[model samples]
Target: MGKKKHEPPPPTGGLDQNGLEKRLCNCICLCQLVSILSGVALLYLSVIVVSPSKQTLDAEFESTPVVCTTLENMRNSTNCSVLSCGEWCISKGGSTCAIIHAKVRREGSAVSFRDCDPVRATFCSAQEYNQTQQFICSEGEDKTGQCDALDRFMDCKPIKNKADDIKTEMTSLCRNITAIRDCRGTKPDGTQEKEIHVCTRYTCNALNGIYECSTGNCKKLENPTCVDRCSNLDMGNMAVVTPDLFHWGRCRSAFSNGTRIWTDQQKPLSMYCTRIRNVSATEMEAEDCLNGTLMDAPSFRQITNYKQMLGVLERNEEPLFEDQSFLPSEKTVEIFNRTKVMINVLGCVNTLRKECTTWLAHKGRDGSEGMHPAVYPCFITPHATNYVITDYDRQATVSQLVMASAVPSCLLLFSCFCLCLCGKTVGVNEFGLFFCKPCHKQDGDGGKEPAKLRAP
Candidate 1:
């Protein structure tokens, strides 16, 4: 053979070259898409970490609230599929009526299913009534409770039945009759008069300090009790706050005279009892309470001012008022349970240091008019935070949030590594993940290995 010619292997086979390039390009394109998506995810996560407190929503919303039994029963009674706005009036006829309803969950809220409760229905403002249904929002005081004959008190009055016994009377402030619980009355002669004891909100042990409800079963306990400011000239009992007499009520530092610190420059908050109950006749006590049995408030006789009262009321514990945090089963709205109440994540309450006051917490805070909702008849009921988030429950939500984002975070990291063989970058745009932006050119020397690839 005259110099056998080998023609440079025929430029590597066109089919093989084309197929390999196509496969590589497809892979690179997929990686680019994945990288872009991963980068967005990372950025989103970063933004959340540095963003406003997640508690911001919590500030205005009760995260996961349950319906009070009285209201829940109302919900069960509704036979209609589509609902209407409600006008719940505890005592109607005029502005004097105590409208009992809450904001319902909006048509599209995270927990809109809660709107199933009747208290929220028929209670929304005119602006956002359900569009599909014929909306009806009454303009003035609601009269729905009229048929029910709710005992709505326009003002508190003295008990005329007691026959000149001015010490006790009928008042919107309280309902059930109460005996002067535990205290020694002081006469003008400066001598002790009668020593008596009555139902107190807390069961206490003197040495150990105050603890739980004095009433073994707060549900059955129906007497309304509280610690009001006293005056030296006043004839009210000079009794120390005993275990049974735990402090409960809205002792807001601003509106209230905390620890009486206003008079003197003290670092703490305090209040003064200017007007309080004057003693009468009735109940008496029979106990030494030596073994922490009769625990008194810290510095009872010398109670000057509340040390710090504002933040304390906001705690998730059962509300301080007998009228607050009571289960629907607790039939009675204690004398102190006012028409106005604080609706919060804790529950519908007569007193709340935080948030504004409103009636008819028929809806959630995010509902047409939002609030921590509750419902009750003016009868006896169990006292507790049936609707408030327990400490254990409040704690459980945070971990779920962290665990929920774990999968996405790992997926993002995994995507970064996979793209490495082609091309990828991390920490781009502070949190951006960039993938291979590759371009291929037809080789002048023909396809040898492949286009020059970049490391991820």
Candidate 2:
């Protein structure tokens, strides 16, 4: 009987399957809601992290730059809670920050804080960087007092090995004039036969018969019957003449008149002076001739001029001449050391050259207004936006004077800027609007209204 009763374990005690499913779904719904809320919170945090607030500092100070202060001073700052509105010019690396009263009026530039030595800041120009590099690498120009020696001999090309014909002909001419009867009758012994030397060191060859000679030294004739031609005019101080001088005469076949001879019917017979030693001669002396020296050029005088030019350029000194390439002199160095204000002015000039070269390649080759940008990578100061456009226009003024020949259009743009700054009609707005200011006075009186514009 007990086994039969166990038949269907009285169907599982009444269970609420729907209610269990409903409970599970409710739990899932709660988890989804939590997940959605979490996502929304995360989105809110992300937005807060990325978007920075636009705020302005409003502290006022004199035109001097505010340098780093001590910790005590910073703690004592009353306005520490608010961002300072003064000019904050950060260095290129964003490491150093200085609050300058003067604003940076250019884009892509930062206030330079790297300490520059007096000498380096004097003649600093971007174009001269390579020159400066070379100057640094080298010890300096050779200033030693040594005479610059030069060659004293002519650079004469020697006769080729096949000049045997010229040699033979010259020897024959010498031999032909070896002996001569006293034709001048300088020696008188009444009728006795007087033997006189026709030419000294007489040499003979088949090409030319006898070359005349008088003593150990052979004298050249004005018109010789021999094949070789020699000069009748005396070559004074022949002992002083170098062998090269004679070689040159031979190469050119110089005649008695110092001109070369040429003829269609005759071969070129070059008469060159040959130095021969005569063993039989009792009297023989050695002599030397002088040569020319190289003359110094006029350009050597420029060294002195450059020194003077450099002196004038120092101390914002008005230059005497514009064309001269200037160098820094002791005076310039003195001025640089004495005045920081002047150095700042020159710094602007150096900055001009440094930034302009970057855009030179992109500008028009013709003399148009286009030029390399005269701005550099710089941080934005509080007053940067306020003065950028206006200062750019002012910079054009100086640019016009210096670079008029290079870029005329840029000069014109600069001129327009100067005109606008001086013109009464132009008015500046906080958000950078350039337009003619409205008349606040009667037609006769100048616009007397103050330019104090309200921030929009």
Candidate 3:
């Protein structure tokens, strides 16, 4: 018999070549369709995942009350009075009432009593009194026995109301001294002294050639020369005076160096006794004093304004909602007209310093617009578009879009590879691609061989 033709064992699974090819083509078509559909679905899902929706939200804002309280209550108050006074005293080259008040408060009983407190005649001496009497009698128009008698009488009669008498006598004496002088013939510094009479009031100290009594009473001198032995004029402490005072105010320095410098040349030194309006428990509002005019505490309305930017929306105004289908025509107008909104004042400084201000408002869920107590740096206007622009578009970044597209692209490439191998002599059945090498029986030759490919 003719050797049997070695036709490739009947196409696996009892399927004819035509039948197997048909089944493989059908599988490739199904896989290609699945890949295309999956890719399209993935692309659609990616767009939905990254695209940001645009909507106009009706934003309503309110503000908390600006409760006035001391810095001690605010938990930031400091004893800067010492530095404040020392700087002022140094600036004018003299001491002031504010300085004396500060000294007395800080140093307690250690501070020498001026004639302001004559009950404590700690520095008064008979020798000083005799010299004062002699100088007064000599300077008067009547240098006769009458002036000496008057001086004697004043010295003896001052016990009844010592404080009253001292104030009266000191005021008279200070007014008479056209120029400052050393009470003793020679200067206290042991130098030859000329014709100036030392004046004593609350305390004994040499006065400047030109001096004026500060407003309250003669108890404190406005512009007296820095001659008191007890005056602790420390340059180090005074050097930090401006920063300390600014710190007391809690002001953010507009200077490039982030500090406020105090110099004689700078107008309106930072140590001036300025007032803040709309002061709250945590915040202090600074105000400018014009022509030395003292400003009164801010009114409630002004305080409210300082804390918030209030506005009234007119009826029929453009609706905050981009899609108003859910809102009634009349309701929209009513809500718009009734709703009130306010933005917080960024800086605590007065209205004159607008450059430091921010347009951002503190927004809260409830109507009560309370905020945590913290200082915020000024916002960059150019970068802060979300704050000012009510209606703006937001979109996903380029990187997100790329990632969304890449995942589906990889899936499509994998599916295409499977499609290309569909009709080969490999396992491709209704259950899908299966490896047959593990399940196949080994031939007598000891070589592992694949089982016949199954046809769907």
Candidate 4:
């Protein structure tokens, strides 16, 4: 019976093989579908899923670009500007990623960003400020905590009409003006440089070509509308005209040496030295008394701070005019005669008439002489009051005469106009108007030459 049962099982072996083949095919299809579904899930997550904390911010600025992985890092990054994180993404490998991007547009030497989270401000190069080099942006600090707290500061303020608020805003803006009072830069030499912020509209002045600090405003440095008489170098707030000063120095030297005489128009005429005194002996003594006496006597030499010296003159109590006398009265007489002769020779009669008529209209003859008013004796001009002749030469040499007459012909009218100005007492005749004289009365004869008339 056991032999017969085994024989029946052997007969069904072919069906068992067919059943095994069907099961193998179903397993391969299931594996393929599972692989495709896994890929689909990954792609879906890539498009929508993102981490909240991990972010990157990018800014294109003149200074430096910034990239940060989180908003907290962004706030700490020195190169970060006025921006915040907006969106983020997670990588397929489950890596968290964040990004922020911004661009700055400005044309200036330096630009500063305000309201930035981590990196607050950056400076740019300008024509004047930091002339030596441009500032570069660099890493600043670490901001780890307070990530959610910063969002509270991000709400945009509603725009409002600013015409009236502008006035108040101006005051509010300037409220911090004096708050940064200790902004002065220190030099290596232990001196402090003046501190001024050049970024403002109220203080800007076009008269200044560059930015400067006004009392409370930023002002522009102005170019000279008139001639530029000085350099950009600082003279401690008092500008010095070098060329003008140099010319004055030359004139002063010539004047003191008694070897040069210049016209009112700065024309060198003749070399003549005439002795000058300090008004009176007692005048010098009074000066000596007020200033507690001098180391030496007061001479014709120019004094430093003459205005201060004049103040001393006002308070002087001692007699300074006593015993004061003119040197060589005969020389004075000869000069007077020569002047009279020149008047007659030059035929200034008509000019004199016009000037006298004008003068009488302006200043009536109460005690003043009409045609020839005496202002310190030697001065003879229409507006010669308070004027004095500093020097006089008997005869000018030919060389001196040429130099005196060599001024540009174009300036003749300008010189005349300047003389007619209110503060000017010297007239055109002093610089012009040649005198023709009788042969005996000419400069070469009988006139005693002063020291100033000597050749240099």
Candidate 5:
């Protein structure tokens, strides 16, 4: 007989097609749940965890304390830090009071009382205690005699003559030589020591009886000889030197009734003028003018009656200098023009000593004609009138708008994509339950055959 063929083992725990389908359905549902949970976690990290961490960092930065050590640093510190340091200094009296006293001696009345607070008077009085130290450290000590001689030189006014300019030059040279000799101390061999002198420039207006000099290398005058008179004889009507465009010489024009009026040769005009008039008990109208039109208005006043209007000069009891004729020499005019062009090019408006706005109003029958606009409609408007958006505000608004729209939309799209990929379902019943029932197949011996699974 032939060897019996090995019979194939029957499949264990056989499942039908329906059971395979149910298993596949369960697997898909599990995968979908996992994907949804993963998406939610991603969203939490993106929106809640990461974003809140940045916010927390910003909050920490804002809450951080400002630290200042030295007095100079304390002075330049933030308001909160300054207050804290001041309080600390106040509590730590003795040494801090000495320090405050030193500062008061150096800065004089310019020192801020806020830093010393309740002890300002004590700090000020400390100067008396330290007077000997001030004298010991003074720059004026070694040069006292020379400075007095220089002061005498400044006082001596020679008789006005043809050789006066030459005499003045010699006097300046002698004073400068004396200043340099005095600033340098004598060595062991009687030779002058080579030490640098630190000099500060000050306007004549700032100078009082005694020249307040800072302690450094040594003290020296910028101009060794003071100006007893104007240097140039050509400076006619301009007795006082002024840093301005139309300074007692250069002509300025104004508009009246659609006509440009030039000032007299003796008196220079102002560029702009302001006039005020009473409209009611509670209200008044003001008008301002440039060379041509009223600055506040779009249209020019074609029909202005100067006679009917009472000028500000009449209301105020200020006297108008009617007898004076302010005629400047040709040299003075040239200097004024040159200085004006230079300052204008450099944009040094703050340095101008006499601006057109500073001109006083004068209305008289005779010689005060070109002083300032009298009955002219001139108004003083507020410097800044329009609303403006700053760079910081604009940037903040843009950032807020972008965050409001972009963040939510991005999260929503990510969630939808995750659901589409992992949670696709095909069959469902009327009761909203997923249909996946197992079905069995009969074999020739009345036994069930294993079901082959299909991918969903």
Candidate 6:
């Protein structure tokens, strides 16, 4: 009988096979569920990615003129418009083809402009010509009798009556206002760009197909909106339709030597947006936007902080902290500093927002409530303030974020909820509590002993 005995019958072969099958089924179902959830999240992200809607278009004008002395042979061009002033500096409509404020090449054979230098660089490219540019006559050439200095240095005119200070309080205000506007961008586009403006808004009215760059024909949108507020590319902030400092291309000096005029706007490693080691004062060379940003800062141009000044200006007319002269008084400095702080935090949710949107038929609930839309921003047009931040508004990045972040989060939560209802939590091994059976898990007798195995 012992010789005839075979190996002990396998214990419950059917039960082992059934358990394995159940685990495999659970894994497959979980995978399918995760895949479906990911798809849904992606679809949602796509829906929000849309072309920016048309924003309000209000005209901005700074009629007060600055009394700048004209350069010899430098004359205003018909094409001197905000859309074309940056380009008009180099055009050849006789010697007068250059912008009114453009310098003349005294040494060159042609009646050519002196490469815009300090004058046209900002009008042309802000990153290339930041805030260091200024309109001053050469110390030797600015004399009362030199190169129509009478007209060139209108701001330097003296009064015979009284103490020879400001002509009048009102005149002083006009001059100061003009000086402030000039410190930033001048004659920026709503009216005419080629024409040098003393107190013009340093902006490009950020509507698509509206503003164009002087170099590379780059439209304003190439620079994305960084501030949650306005988008003007003047010298104050890096926002769109706004711009600012010691960066190259804005200007090489208070005067021009010709070679520093034209620069590429689609900034590359070799692009001349900064001074090369601060050498070649005539070349507008900068290799990085961040470097340029630091160099042009008003509060601390010498320090290189990674953060940029974005949406800091509601009115491009504000004085810059970098130039103490622009901030004539302590009160002014305090006011501007407070303004920058507030706008940086609240965006264009204040006066600038109202002024920017009042003309644009912003008929939202806020508009009806006698206020600009606070829930959404007013200056949040398509034009962004920075190039790096533009990617977030892109469709591809949004989709990836949803898939990468949402799926794992959902799975973790699902697993935790699942554990809360479990009856059997197998553990005390290598992988503790890896799997478990729910309290209501189905059994042939529903937790009761099977009739066949029950004690009589």
Error of 2 at 418 (Å): 67
lDDT of 3 at 39: 85
Per residue, candidate 2 scores C-alpha lDDT tens digits across 63-139 of 32211111111212333222111111121221111111221221110111111111110111111111211101011
* Candidate 4 C-alpha error for residue 313, in Å: 2.5
Q: Which candidate model has the greater TM-score, 1 or 6?
A: 1
Query: Worst 10-residue stretch by lDDT in candidate 4?
Result: 52-61
Pick by TM-score: 2 or 4, better one:
2
Model 1 residue 61 lDDT score = 33
Candidate 4's error at 334, in angstroms? 24
Name every residue pair that clashes in candidate 5: 18-438, 19-438, 275-378, 287-378, 287-379, 288-378, 288-379
Instruction: List, residue by residue over 1-456, the lDDT tens digit for candidate 6.
Output: 133333322222222334644574466457557656755654543332211110111111112211111211112435522211121112323222322221111111111112233321222221211222222211122221111111111122221222123233211101111111222122334333342222211111111211222221212222221221112323411211112222322431221223322122311110112112232433322221111112224442322221223212222234322342321222222211110001111112212233323312221122121111212111112233110000012234345455655665677566545544332432122222233333223233445533333223
TM-score of each: 0.23, 0.16, 0.23, 0.15, 0.21, 0.19
In candidate 1, which residue ranges exceed 4 Å CA deviation? Answer: 1-20, 45-399, 424-456
lDDT of each: 0.25, 0.22, 0.26, 0.21, 0.24, 0.24
Candidate 2 vs candidate 5, TM-score winner: 5
Cα lDDT of model 3 by residue, 1-456, tens digit: 444443232213233235455565566677888799878967664544333221111222111111111111111224323211112122332222111010000000001101111110011111222233222322323213112222101211111222332333332222222111212222356554333232233332222233322221122222233321111221111011110021122222212122232222222111111232333443333322111111111321121211111111113233212353311122322211111111211111122333112222211112111112111111112222222211122223345455666677777887888866653435533334332322323231245343444443
Which pairs clash (backbone N, Cα, C closer than 3 Å) in model 3? 114-202, 114-203, 115-201, 115-202, 181-196, 181-197
Q: How much RMSD separates candidate 1 from the native structure?
A: 23.7
Candidate 3 error regions (>4 Å): 1-9, 13-41, 50-254, 257-396, 424-456
Full-model lDDT, candidate 4: 0.21
- Model 5, which residues run further than 4 Å from truth? 1-194, 197-223, 226-248, 252-267, 271-456
